[model samples]
Target: MLEEAEFDRDDAAPIDMLESYFAAHGWSHERDDDEIVAKVKGSWAEYELRAIWREDDNVLQFLAFPDVRVADERRATIYETMGLVNEQLWIGHFELWSTSGILLYRHAAMIDGEGGGTLTLDQAEMLIESAIDECERFYPVFQFVLWGGKTPKEAIAASLIETQGEA
Candidate 1:
């Protein structure tokens, strides 16, 4: 829940900043963050999934997932899967900004907002991998939307960009 940021004009690209920051904290992206952000913004292909994790005061603890796609029945399927009808959970996208792991986006949702929960490394990895696997399972529908026919790994990298404006 980070408020307005007073960003420095000389701030490095988010990916670089995040990597250095995470490395300092003993964390690292599975792949390069710069390339991922570029691909997502450029939209070379449809990223199939996206996710983010935040801690107290809106600082992001973790962020990952495949990019999003907007094709055919797949779009509907994704929304349906994520709807969580009776559950209170919602999907959130995180944009990188600081070396301290703070998020820049404001529109992030609270999945199961009524009952907040903790996220562990295992949970984060599971959620991200599951989303990628689900998208792969529904390849026919997802392929036509955003992935631009690239492999799942590429899509995952693209997802790291963390678009703030797009829903």
Candidate 2:
């Protein structure tokens, strides 16, 4: 028989920290067990973001699903595009949920002090912000491949902006 993990009441749990973090940012969110669900509006589209706390691993994983869904026929191309996009990202990577054909941007942060250390609000905010920024940055490229019928290489090439100089 496995025993349930015990957490200190005096200190806020990881989920609680995440909830408070989102609220501070003025974002509406829901907390269910170990998962925090929130909607973030980006330049490209609104995303459904979920943050899951894994006690055993001491890792908080964030996943954001874009409003667009890839058709079965386009999965291969989209997946290829994702491969190229993932390389340019500093924090998270985009992936396709094969079973549902949904594209998701994912990133995880290791919550330090797992034994007794608390996860600071600053750390939580950083994790969420990084994921959102990465998703918004590459969202258009994904759309170009899925709906615009652009090849993976072409879509990626077009998304790269060549800054000329200060005008």
Candidate 3:
């Protein structure tokens, strides 16, 4: 679990940059040295966005966990759905945390520069925005499988139905 960061805003830490981004977006967030967690409201549900920065490896991993929970019985179905869902995604992939069976979207980016791996505000915004977009787009498909008892293919199909126009 990441704790609230205690440092001057001028600090050059990547997590601090993210803290400023969250603040600008009016999202609640907490940050430690290596990780920062933010709560963002999406169209379907709230999301817990966790970003871990590794200065040594010059990498950043971003994860978005929707409020949806996969039940023990639904794990098999969700797992199958996970594979199919990942097939359609271009940015990141979805997975179920083995221990908790929690569904989450994950993406990792390699940051390389001569001086160091510096995280820019624009990069942070893009990473988080994409994650939130993917989650909102897919949350209903997970719901379709979980409660609607729809097959993986069926759930994906239902989610793709394009409404013609305004009702």
Q: For each candidate in turn, give its C-alpha RMSD to the true structure in angstroms.
A: 15.4, 7.1, 5.2
Best by the lDDT measure:
3
Q: 1 or 3, which is superior by TM-score?
A: 3
Report the CA-based lDDT of candidate 3 relative to the real structure: 0.83
Best-to-worst ranking by lDDT: 3, 2, 1
Return the clash pairs for model 3, or none: none
Per-model CA lDDT versus the true structure: 0.33, 0.77, 0.83
Residue-level lDDT of model 1, residues 1-167, one tens digit each, is 11113222223333333333333334333434222221121123333232333423333333333344334434443343333211222343323333332212223323232334333333333444433344333333334323355344453444434467856
State, as a TM-score between 0 and 1, how close model 3 is to the true structure.
0.87
Question: Model 2 over residues 1-167: C-alpha lDDT tens digits?
Answer: 11112222323667887676666566789999889998878888888889888887888888888877888998888878988998898887889888988888888777676455356655665677778787777887887787787888888777777779897
Which ranges of candidate 3 are over 4 A from the true structure?
1-12, 164-167
lDDT of 1: 0.33
Q: How many backbone clashes does candidate 2 have?
A: 0
The superposed Cα distance between candidate 1 and the true structure at residue 46, in angstroms, equals 7.1
Tell me the tens digit of each residue's lDDT in model 3 across 1-167: 11224323332557777887787678999989899999988888889999999887888899999987787888999999989889988888999987887899999987765546667655676788889988988898999999997898999999978889899
